[model samples]
Target: MNEAGDTGLAEVRVDVWLWAARFFKTRSLAKQAIVGGHVDVNGGGCKPAKTLRAGDRLRIARGEERLEVEVLALSERRGPASVAQALYRETDASRLARETARAERRMVGATAPPKRPDKQARRELRRLKDGG
Candidate 1:
């Protein structure tokens, strides 16, 4: 059989893999990310149709977080979270970088208001906006 060893599968599209791997909520979103150049394979940008096989490396930029992963398996159909996670193996460096970035973001976010203002605060803000 092929590398993934599931029903003799051979190829899986990049976008389909991303979605099936739980990187994107839907296939359309994965396609959008691919078309927007946020997904790369083997150190270069690739089309959504690019086939991914076992051992292929991927660099994905999702919002402010970046991920580097190696394809451990291939699946064209989306599955449960636990199964989806099995499709790829994230590099240690990528996980560490993501954690560090999240920590920094949390630190910076501490300066912002945690929740919406109460009714009185809204009235005061409205008054200020009206210049009165």
Candidate 2:
């Protein structure tokens, strides 16, 4: 049992926690994300090896998706998705916002193909896009 009085909980590195929680595919990627400022621990910037305790807040980004979760438990091993879910509790608003953003981006991307024109348009678009 840990300080939180939960036998399932453990103390682990932030990167490992993120990986085990399924935030990133690998610990290295999680570290990269942390260094890239795409992952926030306890509402502030943290290193990959920062120690994470139960109830800590994490904001993680995967591509265009962002997630906010509260650490419910900690595990160092990469386990199954179901097991991973047991380690954290995602906020409802975060889930909804991520889904909506993903849908909106998908829709925009799908419709954006026609917006790109030929070579002439490319030159003009570049000028406009770059504010040149």
Candidate 3:
């Protein structure tokens, strides 16, 4: 029995762990994000192959959402949502910030115009573009 079997994991690659934790849909996406400098570990940038263990701190940026999480466990294989959730614990501040930003976006978006114009509206737009 190895350490992996004894404790589920001894350590895991940062990108692999992110994918296993469901942060990224695929390992390739996780690797891309890591290589692009979208992830930080222990307040410092790390390579995709960086080894992560329990208690490690991770700052991950996924588009409009940013997360600060403390590693709680490690796994090399992706699992169900409930299982994945156990692998890391999110900080309250990170959760609050993400929710607040989402709320603000919703409030501001309510007053925005529809994404696509109607046929009549397009004609009007064309006329305006043509300077009458």
Candidate 4:
């Protein structure tokens, strides 16, 4: 067990810390993510019970967004997002990569044509092409 006094610092369970830090709506969700293999601590995959400490880096994915953060402090109680943001700092590279990927996905989706065909329009086009 980490005996580090609260300079707002210490090692704590990843699931608990994630909930306290407002990364998820609840501790159970964080645990689910860990078990689902979506959370990485210190550049390695970890269980929900894994201990996290100050300066340890984490890679977490929610939907299409991936977050990379360095733990700065530990907490046991849930907090506001602003306070949670203070508990960890996001890496610039991760932020940029997520943003770029999201934008590219949006562009590709927007440029793609509709897959379904309208019955009347299809018949009319066929009639014209066949000179009928």
- The Cα RMSD of model 3 versus the native structure comes to 3.7
Which pairs in model 3 have colliding backbones?
none
lDDT of 2 by residue, 1-132 (tens): 232223364568899788877888888999999999999987899998889999899988888778999988878777778888888899999989988998898898888856558899989989999998
Candidate 4 global CA lDDT score: 0.84
**Runs off by more than 4 Å, candidate 4:** 1-6, 115-132
**Superposed model 2: Cα runs more than 4 Å off:** 1-10, 115-132
- List model 1 lDDT by residue over 25-120, tens digit each: 989999999999999999989999999988899999999989999988888777788887888899999999999999999989989776899999
Error of 4 at 112 (Å): 3.4
| Order of the predicted models by lDDT, top scorer first | 3, 1, 4, 2
Number of the top-ranking candidate, with lDDT as the measure: 3
Tell me the lDDT of model 1 at 83: 82
Clashing pairs in 1: none
Q: Cα deviation in Å at residue 66, candidate 4?
A: 1.5
Q: Order of all candidates by TM-score, from best down to worst?
A: 3, 1, 4, 2
Candidate 3 global CA lDDT score:
0.90
lDDT of 4 at 16: 91
Q: Which lDDT tens digits does candidate 3 get at residues 1-132?
A: 222212467788999899988999999999999999999999999999999989999999999899999999888878788888888899999999999999999999998877898899999999999998
